[model samples]
Target: MHLIYLDEAGNSGTNLDDPHQPIHTVCGVIVKDSQWLPIETQIDALIAHLVPRVADREGFEFHNSDIFQGHGFFKGWPWPTRVDALERLLDIIVTNKLPIVWGAVDKQKHKAKYVYPAAPHDMAFLLCAERAERWFKNHAKDDVGMFIADDTKAKSDMKKSFKEYRKTIALGNRKECLEHIIDTIHFADSRETFGISFRMRLTISSSGILWAPLELSPFLSELNGMYMQEGCFRKKGAAK
Candidate 1:
């Protein structure tokens, strides 16, 4: 059996009037039944390495809860530290060869259209759904289920959108098709929320990795080019 949990990092909407910055990312991780404990242990070790004293002081053991809370140590740290932590988390995901998926949406396109922009949360969920579909298609032999944290209200909204999306894809009222998709889709608030009877274990990764490489290289380069050419963010009274 396969279990996948969804999480996201980064803000979707930046200061609107600022033209120089416009990128939103959605990241996801997928794991099989056997990998849950090893992944969790690795994450705990990484956190301890990053901030041993914080864990010792608080007597708060790391669990699924800490992923969304910034894990306590990263709250007000400098940008460099935050970036480093994000990189380390990404390294863990890549090292494990876990299924990681992400999408970077161009903010300028929505702004130009002047429509109510899709929230970052919505985009993240859509990305998750897309990745889940891909995984399902690729692994025909496996029984797949989705377990997502109650990290944000966006997740609940995404569940609704995903149902609609499935309907569109199924395109008919056949019971067999609906049952097939329903068997594949399962939502849980957290690992604990779902009993351990399910064969699969759980894994978590930072969502920030979705944007790190892109922001560090090509995406930033393109943005810089646009800024240099038009002086967009530097314009008099411009907002960022």
Candidate 2:
């Protein structure tokens, strides 16, 4: 069995047209349940290793956005120092040999199509979850996995979208992917959990893949062909 940490980056909410955040990324960090303890311990010990906040608070959360934006515990840190800490975190992920599956959408490109079951973020979640399900089923038939995500205030719609997928997966009309995931997802507050804080340790790879929609990025023309060949990376109903 495995426990997968699921989260997203570059969320534009309902504004897929937002110029700044043209992309929405969803990541699944798949770790064997057996090794979760040691991996969590190693990452938690580093909370005090990097730049720390001096306020009278109990502690701080390690968020990718806050670190990149020089806020919270990452505030007042030199650029290189922050970069180094992030690299060290990535090293932890690589050293552990974690397998990650991710999906991202160039929102602007997708928005142009103007057809989808839900918003971009919800769509991204469903699409990404399907890939994770495929990975588990494809590898070992007996393997099972559950999802844990950072608890966010506005996740009702996303939850509904996932439920819809699971509800209809057996109808044959929804063959784009199947849902072998555990029935309900678990959530943790990032402020209280090391796993959620490190959930996106593998976003860099997904970002590289979803940097720009294939249609708009001339450089990724051939790479887009490879994605089509794989088929699972495509949006629902898009695979031929």
Clashing pairs in 2: none
Give the C-alpha lDDT of model 2: 0.64
**lDDT at 24, model 2:** 75
Off by over 4 Å in 1: 9-21, 53-72, 75-87, 111-124, 169-240
Off by over 4 Å in 2: 51-57, 115-117, 168-179, 201-240
Candidate 2 has its poorest 10 consecutive residues by lDDT at: 212-221
Write model 2 residue lDDT over 54-96, tens digit each, in one string. Answer: 4533666767666667887678877667666665665666677
For model 1 the TM-score comes to 0.54
What is candidate 1's local distance difference test score?
A: 0.45
By TM-score, who's the top model here?
Answer: 2
